[model samples]
Target: MPRRHVKLHARPPQEVQGEAVDVLVRRGLDDLRRELDVPPSFPPDVLAEAADVVRRGPSGSRVDATDVPFVTIDPEGSKDLDQAVHIGRLGDGFRVQYAIADVAAWVQAGGAIDDEARRRVETLYAPDGRTPLHPPSLSEGAASLLPDQVAPALLWTIDLDAAGAPVQVGVHRASVRSRSQLTYTGAQAAIDDGSAGETLQLLREVGLLRQAAERARGGITLPTPEQVVEQGADGVWTLGSRATLPVEEWNAQISLLTGMCAARLMLDGKVGILRTLPDADPRDVQRLRLSAHALGVPWPDGATPGDVIRDLDAANPRHAALLTDATSLLRGAAYVAFDGELPAFTMHAAIAAPYAHTTAPLRRLVDRFVGETCLALSAGTPVPDWVRDALPELPGLMSAGDKHAAELERGCLDLVEAALLTGREGQVFEGAIVDVRADRDEGVVQLRDPAVRGRIEGAGLPLGEDVRVRVVEASVPQRTVRFALADDQADSASA
Candidate 1:
């Protein structure tokens, strides 16, 4: 991956003119309030009451969690801890001990908490903070995999062979005692410094092997920049890059592996929604191929586009650029639910597998239903009526949540970037060429450092990743930052 550099100059926050951030906020709040019908309070008793109801439900099996060495890996200060994983060597493969918080264990079928959870549908993240799907008292406290706390969970042990293929999977309900709470950054640092504990080392190893396997399977590895907004002492918003460590990616890979297995089961039974995206169109592939060739990147002949992507992403900066640029081709995602048989297009282009959202039940409502169903099926228990009822509505609800969340996150980013750029209006700053449009009328120039991009002139200038440019204008009110040629106007005229 290409390294990103930053040039920082300290300055106070300025009022961004022209943009109505309040309108965006209002719209976001309205979506949460009106569309989701989010509950007003984060009460502890709600979860406790729900758990009591589930406890009384008829089931021949028992669930516990106090013995398993489950641990959570999330961002520092994250309240809604969703998952805890443990991995170890098993034969020539590895045993992945993943403990996902059992939201279904607590939230009763057709209860108030369940209704509220369904209403929220998904968690909302804003510049200020997050509106968690579950109350903090349960999500952050009781059910969370806090150190030494025994919590009810759905435990999955997946055995992956040395080649990183999952050979076997075991699912059960249990009470787990988390040894400690680990942050992704902390775990990554330990792996880097070679002083990581046994558990963390296993995590790093598993993640590495899984990543290698995915690459071998022709999965697209794109370098996409993520923006995070942090509040300052003066209540000003500042933009920062969100670093995704190898371990984080690996952790996600494990989640994908589990979801894929669950999806396979659902499909074999010929029912349930699977997260699906069609393979890239041939024209898009051709365009990508030509672009890579134009950039002097190696495009492997006689191989699939995925093969070209893998080889290029591994070769040169041009190839890396090519890989990232192809991200826009993957779109028009659909929630596929069928009973007769699985559809031909159930594959997710990114992971190269049929997958579903099944692991993050605490954070996502759809996951709760899917997770519960998976658990019941795995345990040979009858699928709950509420879960059966929930399966159909989840596709639409989750998709709507995805749209709403994306808008809020992107909107907040625009506002913050606009606010940050106000401090440097008419000031020249270095940037990279992220994208170019054939129309010339529509183009975005992304910066490499201080990393903000914008629509800019593109008549003759080549727009490729990491190509340098300069900021020409910054508007907070308009929620836009403009760029121009970095060289002197005299030099430009002479040229």
Candidate 2:
């Protein structure tokens, strides 16, 4: 029996590069667009109702947004402000505060807002625009953490020790006001120099401490460069790798702290969604070990999976990139909403603990449910039945949402990469081999460039990071890019 062709190998400049490739990749995205069922519009009434809720202060909870000096950091043109943060140095460590938008206040159970939110499940972002789960009036306006507006929020106050590990975590819901809205680029520039404002400086401190703690814990980190497609002067798509600022990762660390804390409480109580991934399979582990050996990366015999990944990441970046594929293989992320018994698997390989999504309620529905559960549990009240009942269905809904998100993103990426390379099909760009598998028919290759990442064809090659390849063929219709060995360069290929 013939094995399924997995990789589309790279080639020399002369064999495959020209106008023919662009036509192929374009057709592929079109097929994805039809298959994915991307939405065209949401009901108008839903948006209007969300706006009403945001404008009207919650009658059940007391909130005062002033005095915290909360500031929001997000991409340019972003309207849904899901979180706000402020940090300050305490006696020997730091006091970090993350204020997440209290979306529950507006989304009352069985209400129109709730119905619409549940129907959409999650926000869908496309190259053209986004289909927001909530109406713009809410997600972009009233519910948004705009500067000087007193909005309801679920605040987490985490006290970090000298090493940046959380010594204490406190959660509560209240009203808060934002000092300003900042962008990653602006904060990054400030951190690079001494000119950082008080807000930016505090953020940098928080980011640094959290990063140090992760490194100390032997957390596996990767440099997953992503392409940001921007429309040019004539409305043509252009692609560039989005810079991952220190502030971005630091912000994520803060969210991790919050989510980990939430997961701990839920697990202790013996119920709730435990975001988990099982340990990597030994087969893939052995393959990675072999790749590590080839790349001069030493794997300590008894090191934890996280530690092994960390060492590999430090030694060879391309091999580290490949580790990402295996990381997800531990287990698919599940919402395990059990009643009394805690499931056997409760560990999140990345965080080294049980974790769940409790942040970013504006964009993700699961977080909203988890946030409500945490709020109720913290207050020593019975977890509401509606939220609990919804738990059973959450896993399926979230899985569907995840699949849609992945397909939509890949579809958009297909368009952007094709458009960027349409004019220069044969042009060679630097890329690292992400994966290489040769079972029977054709050797497969997955390559990563600074601007884009995709699979190609090739085999019997050094599969590790930093191996350079020339872009041999780019087919817009097929949504594929082909690459081949160039100038005797060794490539790191991941499975």
Candidate 3:
């Protein structure tokens, strides 16, 4: 397997996340993976089939779209490319040509590769490495929408009016060649310095327009920075956060538009799975407002949670805490499959619209299926029997995969915290209470110096206030790092 290098997002960087740099940290990661039953490599048969599929190449008459000059944008050194884009003028509207990697071209359904992908469900990432959904030969090579590589793709032609509202959308299989692969910082620099081509300049225009449309629809987009651990030249590991550049968010708008478009197609057919999240419970939003009030964070009257959160800065400790805890509002996300009758609910609250996961097929299992559903529905053909039969179970597999991925992320973070705080037990640290559980004498804390977040055991824990606490326990072997209120301050905390 090719070495996996993935940047992972965690709690807005108010936590300790490990990227193995030393022998001890590396061994601890290995042990942690074993405890979680994470697969280290693909099966022999799966790899053999992947290589054979790549050798045979795409096996259909694909629409030649290489002249469109699409380009891919992702993190630096990224290989598992998934989506590419090119924007052009279309009278009073814009023509957005987005090409997503067509993984179905190489990964035969029910074959060894597909079966293995089903088990994996989605790509699992850590600060150190990742467990990819497909073998690298497909994910990073042939099926990846890499620059200068003519690969099969699901090309989407979405026409958007001047206001960024979609007027028409269509997707079909095609052969595409990305003209360039750009990193976020590089792309943003080009746009800022007036060195960008028409495609990139149009992306900025379309991205801003779409953002306004999202706000009008009461949507919230959380562009969380990734947590990273770097080893210095002297071999000392230090952890930090990678603040996302503007280009990343702009690039993401295109994906979001495509997802919303795909969902429209699936909903029209009424026979596909949707990535759904009902509107946030009103009680949850009220709770957030109360917390913000206690923390002295301003909440203007008539402003929604999305508005308040949009104005927050992660660099502020109080804002960081609020943002971390605010994730609760976006909970209860799950997949819903419908046949003839539409489900009772279908809105993805955060997006404020019907949405499906239709991009990143190389990394996510559901996207491939969603792509197929939209393709068949668009072509006015019968949905494949295999696809129809699998819809019922896809939700369960994806839900399980979501839970497992969360566990893996938390375990890795705990290991890093435990290792970083070795020999620091019984020491007091300054931190802030991010969340308070009314039913229990405990909440969540974000430490000051190391920026670690963990469970806190204390009474009268004020929400979003800085306080001093002692590290009651830090056990590397158990992969645990815990904190408790100091003896003198146990009952003294106030809102």
Best by lDDT: 3
Candidate 1 per-residue C-alpha lDDT over 1-495 given as tens digits, one digit per residue, 9 for 90 to 100? 432323333345454455343444334444444443444465566667645654564233446656656677888878677788787788887888888887776676787777777777778877666778877666677767678876777888788888778888778887777887888878878788999776678776777777777777667656543666666565544566554667777778888889988887677666667888777787888888788778876766676666666444322345445755788678778777654666777888777888888888878888877777777677667777777777778888888888877866766666556556654656766555556665764456655445565677645555454444556666544556777666663255237
Where does the lowest 10-residue lDDT sum fall in candidate 2? 1-10
Candidate 1: Cα lDDT at 74: 84
lDDT of 3 by residue, 341-440 (tens): 8999989999999999998899989999999888888889988787888899999999998888988887777777766666678889888777778688
Which runs of model 3 end up more than 4 angstroms from their true locations?
Answer: 1-21, 223-226, 229-235, 427-430, 485-495
Better of 1 and 3 by TM-score: 3
Q: Put down candidate 2 lDDT per residue, 1-495, tens digits, no spaces.
A: 011112222322221245333333344545666778765666676766665676675546655647888888888878899999888888888888888887887788888888877777889876657878777776887777888888888888888887777788767788889988888778777777888777578666766777666766656565444556555344444455553666787778878888888897787766677677656577867776676676666678877556665434312355544564445445655667765788877887666667899888889888888887887777778788888888888888888888888878887886656545555555566655555565632233433433556555566555555656666666566666666665455243333
List the lowest-lDDT window of 10 residues for candidate 1. Answer: 1-10
Per-residue lDDT of 269 in model 3: 93
RMSD after CA superposition, every candidate: 4.3, 6.6, 5.0
State every prediction's TM-score relative to the real structure. Answer: 0.85, 0.83, 0.91
What are the lDDT figures for the candidates, one per model?
Answer: 0.68, 0.69, 0.83
Error of 3 at 482 (Å): 1.9
